[model samples]
Target: MTSARPLPQYLVSRFHGWKATTYAESSAWYRRLVDEGQRPRAMVISCCDSRVHVSSLFGADSGEFFIHRNIANLVPPHAPDGLQHGTSAAIEFAVTALKVAHLVVMGHTSCGGVAGCHAMCSGHAPQMEEQTSYVGRWMDILRPGYDRVKDLPEDQQIAALEQQAVIVSLENLMSFPFVAEAVERGTLALHGLVQDIANGSLLQLEPSGRFVEI
Candidate 1:
């Protein structure tokens, strides 16, 4: 990249505005957070989509929630294969080190990753079949959930898959022994949620295996 193609003016200006206002007004809070490291009570695993803003939705202050975002907000089964596993590493830190009380797996509507997984599983996306495709392999985590909801109507299938993303992540989270031990000891709780992009409605999964608006 050339120096001429520098950072966008709009983003730079917005950062300046934020530094002048929000950061300036809360400098002490920022200092305290810096001095005393973060001890967030919950760990939120959410989709990479910008529309799903966990902090903004809950009006969370800094140092409140430990947030991790990835394509489809996926957590693969516990694989201690001595390889780098980003999501598993985050989960381990949150559960064993930070000792977060809750683990929330949040998904949302109109998720391109989930939609891509749907298409790939349905044999509609040929490119994803290639062994070199990273996205295709990552999205394979959602394939089991997709299989469960494939019989639904086309319009409903995507939405169901979105919710299924949350379920899949939650199930995978439990596969980590530390997370399950924490839950068993009453130190950690797991939650699954789906957010509607357009209307801003939230649905939480219940014990009965259904998501109801909350």
Candidate 2:
């Protein structure tokens, strides 16, 4: 059990800030959209963490992004899971259905799953638990990085591996039939982004280790 004092103050403050925006949406506008769904221009794959919100980063409204959040923004190739992969579902809807112009797989700094990627190899990670659901499954995409940098400090590896995983996820996305066909026809653009959470910055991933400010 945890005490109230252990909670972070930012949550309290941000919730209040959110209420201001939540109140700004007129009821009639929401009703119109609810009855008739708005088509979003892009699909963003981001982490489920509360702090890494791509919608807020892009200044998008409720239905403006066909956003999908996982433990990390992982896109596994379409296989035997089901006809509906949540991340794949959003991408297919964006490209093949809505015909969105862009699809971005965004990574971020200070991710817990990046740390968990390191932790899993340490023989200390929890196994087969509900709370560990997505992290355990999705973080597998970063296994190569985790093994490569097992000796690095958590803070350093978080940025490095998160960016690497972003690229890897992008590669995985190409394996999907819809995404591949769309790219081949030049109908969609794929972007890889890294959000620098520490300095309140958004960094676009360079092929090198550096990320340029957007």
Candidate 3:
């Protein structure tokens, strides 16, 4: 058997406050969205980090973005084997059904998921290598990124690999046939972003193979 519980009181209170203020003030917009449908222009794939507020970071309004969050903000290579794939499913729908114009894979510094992948690959965390480790299995998608940065000095290794996380996801996202077609037709654009969690600085990767502060 499993257990379920109500939301915490503090969060509930905050929700009520938001409903009374923001929701009430934008009731018409909310009703319009309900009557029509969400036609988000962009799809943001971000990490499950509690500190990364996708909407807040972009100052986005409701229904503006179709967002998906996963560990390390990873996108595994496309595999149409009739298996369950939550992230890939979201990407498929965004590219095919919703026809989003942009797909952004956002990574962040000090990410626990990225750090765990680094540790597991470096043989620093044996428990993560166990067969029962779901996180480890999921993070295997990032092993190539770790391999790319493994030779760097220890002080610069994790941060370098963090950027590689974004690179890997960007590469994987393009592996989906539909996504690739959309980009080829100029209907969709791909983006990679990395944030400095400690300083709130943002960097965006350019097509020219550089990451510049934005």
Candidate 4:
């Protein structure tokens, strides 16, 4: 059996501070969000990295965006195998139920998940190849991205791989029939982006298959 623990004091204090300040100031907005429903205009798929704050980056209010985070910000190819797929489920809900107009895949520089994938694929992390390593299994989704960047110079591979992560997710997003239909009907559009964490710069994937500063 698992044991439950009390909330950490730091987190508790932070929550109280927010309740007294931010939440108190926006009580009506909070109540409205509950009374009505969350109608986020976009769904952003980003990395689970703590530094990648999606809301702050876009200056989004509480209910403005539906964000999903996972290792490497990956979106696996659509699989209807009756499995518990958290990322896919979030994508389905965002696209089908919430009817989000935009789907954005945001990758970031210096991502540990992407680094692990590179290490694993390079045979430097043997333990990650084990069947019991959940992270390793999840990162297998980015193998194709790794392949695309493996030939680059060592110094350039990680950055290239990071962008490829965004590209791979954008490709995978289309594999979902609903997403494909939504794009085809001009109801939803897909975007790919890479954030330079050190400098707070953003690179957007353009139609010409290039990542350009935005």
* lDDT winner, 1 or 4: 4
- lDDT for model 1, on a 0 to 1 scale? 0.93
Give the TM-scores of the predictions, in the order they appear.
0.96, 0.75, 0.97, 0.97
Residue-by-residue lDDT tens digits, candidate 4, 1-214: 6698889999999999999999999999999999999999999999999999999999999999999999999999999999999999999999999999999999999999999999999999999999999999999999999999999999999889899899899999999999999999999999999999999899999999999999
Tens-place lDDT per residue, model 2, 1-214, is 6555644789978876776677455656777778988777788888888899787788887778888888777777667565556677777777888888788888888888777776675667767234557667667777766666667785676667787678778888898888888888998888889888878787776657566888
Per-residue lDDT of candidate 3, residues 158-183 (tens digit)? 99999999999999988999999999
Error of 1 at 189 (Å): 0.5
Candidate 4 structure lDDT: 0.96
Candidate 3 deviant stretches above 4 angstroms: none
Model 1, 1-214: lDDT tens digits are 6558668899999999999999999999999998998899999999889888999999999899999999999999999999999989999999999999999999999999999999999999989978899999999999999999999998899889999999988898888899989999999999999999899999999999999999
Residue pairs clashing in model 4 are none
Kindly provide the TM-score of model 2 when superposed on the true structure, using C-alpha atoms: 0.75
- Alpha-carbon runs more than 4 Å astray in model 2: 1-28, 81-84, 122-134, 147-155, 207-210
| Best of the two (1, 3) by lDDT | 3
lDDT of 2 at 175: 85
By TM-score, how accurate is candidate 3? 0.97
Ranking by lDDT: 4, 3, 1, 2
